[model samples]
Target: MLHIKNITYRVAGRTLLEETSLHIPVGHKIGLIGRNGTGKSTLLKLITGEIHPEGGSIRLQNGAKLGVLPQEAPSGPESLLETVLDADIERKNLLNEAETAEDPQRIAEIYTRLADINSHTAESRAAKILTGLGFDFEAQQRPCSSYSGGWRTRVALAATLFAEPDLLLLDEPSNYLDLEATLWLENFLRNYPRTLVMVSHDRNLLNNVIETIVHLDQLKLVKYNGNYDFFEKTRAEKLALDAAMAKKQDTQRKHLQSFVDRFRAKASKARQAQSRVKMLEKMKPIASAMEEYSVNFSFPSPAPLSSPIVTMENCEVGYEATKPILKRLNLRLDMEDRIALLGPNGNGKSTFAKLLAGKLRAETGQFAKSGKLKIGFFGQHTLDDLHPEDTAYQHLVERMGNGREAVVRSKLGQFGFSKDKSDVAVKKLSGGEKARLIFCLLSIDAPHLLILDEPTNHLDVDAREALIQGLNEFEGAVILISHDPHLVALVADSLWLVSGGTVTTYDGDIDDYKKQVIDQARNGGSGNSPSAVSEEKQPNSGKARGNSKEARKARAEARALLAPKKKAVQKLEKQIQSLQQEIEKLEIKLADPTTYEKGADYQASVSTEIGRLKAEQEQTEENWLIALEELEELENS
Candidate 1:
C-alpha cells in the first residue's frame, strides 16, 4: 500500500497540490486524471521520490518495489533486450559482484539471490514485453541507438513493464501505442498483480483496465470508486451540488444583508440586526466548482464535392518503387465517407492516408480523384512543418491572401486564440495550440476532404473533445488515421483495414477491430509488422491450385455464418448508445440546480435512475462483446 499524507507540492510559487492525502491499497489499479497541466505527472514523480514535496510525506510498505516509466530513454549501444533486462538493477548488481567474488560462499549467495529475483528468465521476459510493445525479434536485437526516439520510448515502457515492480507508475503509456499494442497492454494491466497508478487520456483504456480514479481538482485529490465513466458521473454530480450550494448561500447572504440594512437604525431591531450580521459572518462560504477552459470551434462547411470524392484501383503506394508498403488496393471515398484507417503503427495506414490525400504517388495502377476534390491533409509532422517565427495571425493572413485582419483574428479566436495570443510566435505555442492553428488553417477554405494523421497527439481532453465536435460536424469526406479508440468510435462511420498490402473495408466497428488486433497479438503476430505482403509474385503451383477452391468455399461459408453475429453486434451497439444517451440525459437533469432544489427525494430518484442506466449500459456492453466474440469465432473458423 502507498500512503500520501497531507502532501503539498509547489513549483515556482504555484501550488499544484496542497494538503492532498490519498491511500492506494495493494493490487488496486488507479488512474490519475486531471486537466493537462494539473500535476498528474508531477504527482507520479513525487511518488517515486524524483522530487520532494514541500510538506507531508509519501510512505510505501517496507520492501515494496516501485517502477516508473522513464521520461528519457536510456542512451547506449546496448541491444534493446539487454537495455530492458538492465532494469533489474539488483539482479545485474548480483551478477557483477559474483564475477569478482573470491569466496565460493559469496558466489553461491549471489546465484541464490539471482534465482530469487527470477534473473534467469529476465531476458526472455524482457523479450516478450518488447515483442508485445511492437518490437520484432530482429528489432529487439538491434542496438538502442538504432531505434528512433519513438521506438526508444516504447523500449523504455517495455523495460518498465519488464521490471515487474510491486508498485508501477505509468504516465500516458498508451500515447505511443497503436490500437493493437494498446489493447494488449490493457489486457496485461488488467491481470497485473500489484498496485498501478497510470495517467492517461485514453478513455477505452481507463474504462477497461482501471478500478479506481484519483482526480486532481483545485489542488486537492479526490478518489472515485469506479472507472473513468463512473468518475465523470460522480464528478459531475459533485460539481453540480457544489454550484447549487454556492448559489443558495449567496441568496441567503443577500437576504440577510437586506434585513440588516433596514433594521440596523431601529433601536428595537438593533440586537436582531447585530445577531443576523454575526450569523452571516460566521457562515462558511461555499466555493463554486472550477470551470475548465475549452476550445470552441467548428470546421467550415466543405466545398461541394462529386459523389465519389476519390477512387483507387489496384493502387500501390510506397516511397520506393522497388518496395511498396501497400499494393493491389481497391478503395473509394464518397462524399459522405467518414473512414478510419485501422492498422498497426508503420503498417501503411499513414501511407494509405497520404495516398488518399495526394501527398504520395501510387507506384502502379490508377489513382483518380473528382475534379472538385480539394484535400486538407494533417500528418504527424504537420506541426513541425509550421513556420516557427510566424505568429498565428501571420499564418492565417498569409494563407488567406488579402483577407482582412479582423477576419483572420476572428478565425483564430474561434479556434481558442484570443487577440493577444494570436500574436504570439508559433514557436512559443504548445503542440496542442499548434494543432489548433492547423485546424484553423484547414478551415479557411474548407477542402472537400480532410485527412488527419494522429491529430490528437498533443491535445488535452478538452481539445480532443473540440476536435471530435468539429469532425462530427464536418461536411466533407474524412479519412482519419488515429490510434485513439474514443475519437475513432465517435467520429468514424466506417473502418478501412490497411493490412497485408491490401486496403479493404472492414464490416464491423472499432470494437470489432480492437478484438481482431488483440487476437492477432495473442497468436504470435507482431501487430506492428506490415501485414505479410509478399513482394514477389510467385507462379501458381499445382498444390496451391488443389487447395485454393476449397479454401475459398470455406471462407465464403464462414462469412455467411458471420452475418447474424455481425447483426447482433450492431444491435448491441445501438442498445449501448441508446442507454448512454439516456444516462447522459439523466446526468444533465441532475446537473441542473433546480433539480436539487426539488428536495432530497428528487435528487435521490435522479441518482437512482442514473445508476440504473449505467448498469444497463454495462450489461449492454457485455452483450456486445459476446456478439463480437461469436463473430470472430465464425470468421476464424
Candidate 2:
C-alpha cells in the first residue's frame, strides 16, 4: 500500500494540493482526473520523486519499484526492441557485471540475479509489446531515432509497460496509439498485477480499466469507488445536493436578517437582534462549485447536394511518382455517408481520407466529385499551421473577409473562448484550446464533405464530446480517421478497412474489429490478411466478389430501411439551418452600434431576443443530433 499523509504541494506560489491525504491499497487501479491545469501531471511527478512536496510525507514499502512513462521520449541510439529491454535495470546490470567478472563466485552471483529478474524472456516480452503497439518486426529492429516524436513516445510507453514495476504511473497512455493498439493496451492494463495510477481523458479506457476515481478539486482529492461512468453520476448527485443545502442555508440566513432588521431599532427586541447577529456569525458558509465553461457550437449546414457527393473508380492514392499506399479502390460517398477508416498505423487510413478530401491526387484510375463539392479537411498537423503570433479572433477575421468584429467574437464565444481569451496569442493557448480553435476554423464555412485525420488528438474529454455532438448534427458526408473508439462508435454509420494497399468497406462494427485485433494478438500477430478476413467474416462482401441473387435482395432491403432515416436527417438539417439563420440575424442586430445608441430598454430587448434565439438554435441542434444518431444506428445495424 502507498500512503500519502498531510501532503501539500505548491508551484510558483499557487497551492495545488493543501494538506491532502490519500491511501491507495495494493494492486488498486486508480484514475486521477481533473481539468487540464489542475496538476494531474504534477501529482504523478510527485509520486515519481521528480519533484518534492512542500510539506508532509509519502510512504511506500521499503523495496517498492516504480515504473513511469516519461513525458518526453529518451534520446538514444538503441533499437526499439533494445530500448524496451533496457528498461529492466537489474537484468542490464547483471549482464554487464558478468562480462567482466574475473572470479567464478562473482559470475555465479550475476547469473543468479539475471534468472531472478527473468532476463531470459525480456527480448520476447519487449517484442510482443512493440508488435501490440503497431510496430512490425522490421520496424522493431530499426533504431529509435528513425521514428517521429509521436512514435518515440509510443516506444517510451512500451518500455514502461515492459519494465513491470511494483507501481505503474501512466499519463495519457493512449495519446499516440491507434485503435487496435489502444484495445490491446486496455486488455494488458486490466490484468496488470500491481498498484496502477493512470491519468487519461479517454472514456472507454477509464471505464474498462479503472476501479476507482481520484478527482482533484479545489486543492483537495476526493475519492469515488467506481469507474468513470459511476463517478460522473455520483459527482452530479453530490453537486446537486450541495446546491440544495446551500439554498436552504441562504433562506434561513435571510429570514434571520429580516427579523433583526425589523426589531433591532426597538428596545424590546434589542437582545434578540444581538443574539441573531451571533448566530449569523457562527454559521458556516457553503462554497459554490466552480463554474466550468462548456463548448456549444454546431457546424454550419452545407449547401444542398444530390446523391454521390464523391466517387472513386479503381483509384490508386499515394505520393506523386511513388508507389501507391492504397490501390484498386472503388468507393462512393453520398451526402448522408458517415464512414470511419480503420487500420493499423502506416496502413493508409490517412492516405484514403486525404484522397477523398482532394489533398492527394490519384496516380491511376478516375476520381470524380460533384462540381459544387467543397471539402473541409483536418489533418493531424493542422495545429502546426496556426500562426503563433496571431490571436484566435484574428484567425477568424482573416477567414471571414470583411465580416463584422462583433459577429466574429460571438462565434469565438460559442467555441468556448471568452472575450479575453479571444485576444490572447495562439502560442499561449493550451493544446485543447488550440484544437478547439482549429475546429472553429474548419466549421466557419461549412463544406459538403469533411475528412478528419485523428481529430481528437489533443482535445480533452469535454471538447471531444462537443466534437461528437457537432459531427452528429453535421449535414454532410464525413470520412473520419480516428483512434477514439468512443467517438467512432457514436458517429460512424459504416466502417472502411484500409490495409495491404487497398480500401474496402468493412461489414462489421467497431466491436467486431476490436475482437479481431485481440484474437490476432493472442495468436502471435499473423492474421492481418485483409482479403481472407473480409471474405471469411464480412457479411456483405465487396464488389470484387461475385454477388448472388440473395445478396442483391438483402442489399436492396437494407437500402429501403435506410431511406426514411436519411429523409428524417435531411429534415432536421433544414430545421437547424433555418434556426441558425434566425440566430445570426438577431446577433447582427444586437451588434449594431445604432441599436445600442437607442434607449436602454431597446438595447435590453435586443439582448433578450438574441438570448432566446440562441436557446432555440441549441434545441434545434439537439433535435438534429437525435435524428442523425437514429439514422446511424439503423444503417449500422
Look at candidate 2 and tell me the lDDT of residue 439: 81
* TM-score between model 2 and native: 0.83
> Pairing residues by index, what is the TM-score of model 1?
0.78
* TM-score to true structure, per model: 0.78, 0.83
lDDT of model 2 at residue 317?
82
Writing each residue's lDDT as its tens digit, candidate 1 over 1-637 gives: 8999999999988899999999999999999887766889899989999899989999998999999988788768999989998898888888889889999988888898888888888887788788888888998889999887877889999888888899999988887777777888998899898899998877877899999999998899999989999998888898899999999999999999999999999999999999999999999987667665558656766656667777788988899635899998887888777788887787788888888877789889998988878888898889988899999999998999958988888888889888888999999787778989998998887787999988887776678888897776566778898878999877777777777777876655666566556767777775563232122322333344335334434533543465457658868998998998999898999999999889999999999999998998898899889889888776666
Find the 10 residues in a row with the least total lDDT in model 2.
543-552
Model 1 per-residue lDDT at 67: 94
Residue pairs with colliding backbones in model 1 are none
Candidate 1 steric clashes: 0
Residue 377 error, candidate 1, Å:
2.4
